[model samples]
Target: MLLGGLLGGALDLLYAFGFAASRGVAPTRLLQTIASGLQGQAAYEGGTASAALGLFSHFAMSLAWAAGFALLASRVGWLRQRPAFAGPLYGIVVFLAMRCVVLPLSAYPHPVGFPPLSTSLDLLSHMFLFGLPIALLVARALRR
Candidate 1:
């Protein structure tokens, strides 16, 4: 389980880094941008502290997500048997939950100039950057 969680979290971090690379944006900058959007004024006021907190929070969230995936895979026969597809499926579920449920409920202020195209890009980015890799990793672990 620990191995699976570590692998999942590592893959997520790698995917996030890759996403930043593809966008020609520094990961720190991208995170800062996101933090700003999420936290409003304090995101910029505290600068390094805000970014650090945001990054640490993200890391912790990733670890928890990985752990949850590991636990679910262990308890769910279907997930264990078909991790490849299941992993991606799990990602999709999370994506939908965030987009349709979580974000809507939280009502966080979106950045100005964030248009529909950007929204689509963000969704696709999450799918490939976070979802796909997690799914693949989970699938691989389940295979064994």
Candidate 2:
């Protein structure tokens, strides 16, 4: 779980940072945006403190996701059996949950919309970088 969380969190952050950079967004601002989920518009005012919180919140969420998958995979044999398929599917689920449910419930200030290009990239990153790593790691752990 620890490994999955660290790896997935790092990968996800990297992707987010890279994507933000391509759009002329600074990494700190990106982190602040994440912090906005919890702190709302105040996150932008809090600077590094809020950015740190965002980073911590991101990793904590990654760990939670990893732990959740690990727990489910432990009980469901097939999840451990087919990491590739299950991982991507789980990514989609995570994407939906975050975009649909989690964001709406949080202090996020922006309206949620599935704009095609960004949405596609986000989904792919979650699948290939986030969920895939957690699923693969969990499957490997179970084999031991």
Candidate 3:
């Protein structure tokens, strides 16, 4: 679980950095800005403690998602048989569920500017960034 969480969080952060780089944004600065924005603060403090906490939080959330799928796969015969595909499928379903149900219900943070493009990029990022790593990990684990 620790390994999977670390791997997933690393993948997510790397993708986020790449995405920021593509937009000519410094990854660290972008993250700080986002963090400050979420906190409704004027400036970011750049605290290592906060950063570590954030990473752990992200990792735990990812691990929870993966574990949930593992539990479901254990019970569902079809999912157990198609372990390779199950992860990606679970990722897609989770993404859609979050977008359609969770996000809409929660007053959580979301992108503000670049409406359609931002949302599209977000969706694409989640699909590949989050989905791909989990998929690969699950596939590899099943094969072992």
Instruction: Estimate, for each residue in 1-144, the C-alpha lDDT of model 1 and write its tens digit.
Output: 445445555555566667678879777765564465357556756677767765765656556666677678778887767665666677666657766765455424553343586566655655555555665566566667
At residue 46, what lDDT does model 3 achieve? 55
Q: What TM-score would each prediction reach against the true structure?
A: 0.65, 0.98, 0.65
Instruction: Report lDDT per candidate.
Output: 0.61, 0.93, 0.59
Tens-digit lDDT string for candidate 3 (1-144): 345445665776777777779889775555554344334333246555444444554566678776766566556766656655655566577667766775455433553343686567666655566655665565456546
Q: Residue by residue across 6-117, what tens digits does model 2's lDDT show?
A: 9999999999999999999999999999999999999999989999999999999999999999999999999999998888888888889999999999999899999999
**Which ranges in model 3 have alpha carbons more than 4 Å from their true place?**
29-46, 97-118, 139-144
Candidate 1 overall Cα lDDT vs. reference? 0.61
RMSD of 2: 0.6
The pairs that clash in candidate 2 are none
Q: What is the lDDT of residue 46 in candidate 1?
A: 61
Candidates arranged by TM-score, highest first: 2, 1, 3
